[model samples]
Target: MAYECLFTSPRCVFFTFTLLNQLLPSILGATYHSHDVTSDTVCNRYHKRELQVYMSDPVILETRPESAHMLTLGLSLSCTFEMEAKGFYTTGVVSVVQSMNFRSHGDNCLDYMQTIYEDEDNDMKLKRKKSKKKKILKKVVKAAVLSRRRRDTDDEDGRGPRICGRVLFGLQVDENETLPPPFADPLPPTKPDQGVLSSLFWDAPNPYQSLVSDAAEVDHKGEIKTRLHISNRMLRQNEDVNLKVVYTAYQECDGRRVPESLFHCGYGLCISRSLVNDGLVNCPFGDCADEVDCASAKEANIIAKVLHYERTDETSVWWIILWVLVGLVLMFLACCGGIFLFMRRRKH
Candidate 1:
């Protein structure tokens, strides 16, 4: 079916006109023969008159580069048959791409033409770039899948065998960027041959002693041991912005939980039912306020923690000086210990 165009449609006119040169960017010249220059021309020779804009611009025209803030208008040259709305009856319609350049010799023409040219050129460039990126991503995904399949077949390559495919077209053909290393075999999944006690730390007197950890699967009475690990994360963030005053006229309870404190106290109001009988907590506090069967304490502690745990007292800190001193002392002792062991071995 043949599609018809109105006088207002500049795009249809440009598209119709540019198809003449076997798909090349249009050049500025009068000799260019196009399908658009038929019985209707921009300059009417027979009537000896300037073209009449029979009506307002076309009803719909797409602006290039959707996010383009500036409007780039394309001009089309065409003659009309029957100009409706303005009411004129003509025999034919002209469809040709028209340029806005006025001067002939210098850059004024070049600059105007360049503006239109570059806009279209850049639009095509961006489209090509997006298509290229999508292709690269698809290739990467395919390579990964192929690599996984290859690895599943071969174990001799401790590092999994690489899967490779050619990138059909690329900006840098010879630039060899290697694929990322394959995923490492996860430490035989660390089945945890022995369990660790979070609350009770190992304090060994022997420097070379491998710390022994004993976890009872069953209690002394032979009852089934149900130990739940309760992880309590503490974040004591103090806001300097008098934020409490900003949020409300009076001050509220800032959340400050000491896991070690709770452990030291042994019993407290349950902040979370998850921690009720939970045997383990990742972060332990030194001491916590003892629960006196107080109803409000549970509510108060919860509100404080959720709002933001801000402790009035010192919590966890890694002291640089303390660690340095400890390290130096340990080094000196280690040297002495090594000397003693060597002397004993020599005597034997």
Candidate 2:
């Protein structure tokens, strides 16, 4: 037996021919493939538009050089993301990782230890003097008590000649009081061993530090900013260091399921490509309006104004000083001339 089937849709048409049920599986497979292709095409267009929004404004990462003799401190790594004026970034995570070779041993410690020792010694001396005074006061109090008791017993109030309390109490009297133990000498600072310094300072050859921004969100026209601090203990001089930043953005589509591949603005907001540079904030949170976008142009304008004012101020200061000096010289010359004229007139 032979059978024929026809299927029609606005965008798709399918025709099938089968002998009994032998061709049924092939027909079903063809329909399934067509559906999948249509779905993929739609998803691709959506993904491309979403990526354009994210890539419109680039993220910036910057680092400052840190220097230290024995310890390097405050090596700062900054991550700046330019947000659209009206756009917002939904909940996202930003991670900053820094890796470098740090040395555990350095010769500068010798100089550093000298200054430390001087301060420690001065403090110890002051403490020792204070302790000595306290001990002397304790000794004086004990001596005075013993002398008063001896004199009081000598008066013997008719009680079969009162004996000295010291003898009655069977207490041995020492002519001199024993002093309290002296303070122990401060231990000298020891030099760290070069061979084992690395082991003692760090556990790994290349140490890496990471800063993560959890629950990070940017409002419409706001910035996503974070700073990573690399301490001197983690950095060494003349070592190559690398820094990396990773960010994941969240988007909201008003309850529509966003494809996993599409980039989104935070707080369930969808970002549009036309929003970039449109000067209108679209992100519900206003995370897009911060200075990250158009930072170069804004910074240039600021720098120009600052430089102009600085130069003008400098020039004005010099001019004022010059005029003051000239007036002083003129005044001195006039005074000298008047004195000379007065002397001549007096002689005449």
Worst 10 residues of 2 by lDDT: 110-119
Estimate candidate 2's alpha-carbon lDDT, on a 0 to 1 scale: 0.26
Scored by TM-score, the top model is: 2
lDDT of 1 by residue, 199-232 (tens): 1211101110111101101011111111111112
Candidate 2 lDDT over residue span 37-83, tens digit each:
11222113223101111322222121213213223443332111122
Q: Cα lDDT of all candidates, in order? A: 0.21, 0.26
Q: Give the range where candidate 1 is weakest over 10 consecutive residues by summed lDDT.
A: 241-250
Model 2: residues >4 Å from true position, as ranges?
1-55, 60-221, 233-241, 246-251, 255-348
- TM, every model: 0.15, 0.20
Which RMSD values do the candidates have, in order? 40.3, 40.0
CA shift at 52, candidate 2, in angstroms? 16
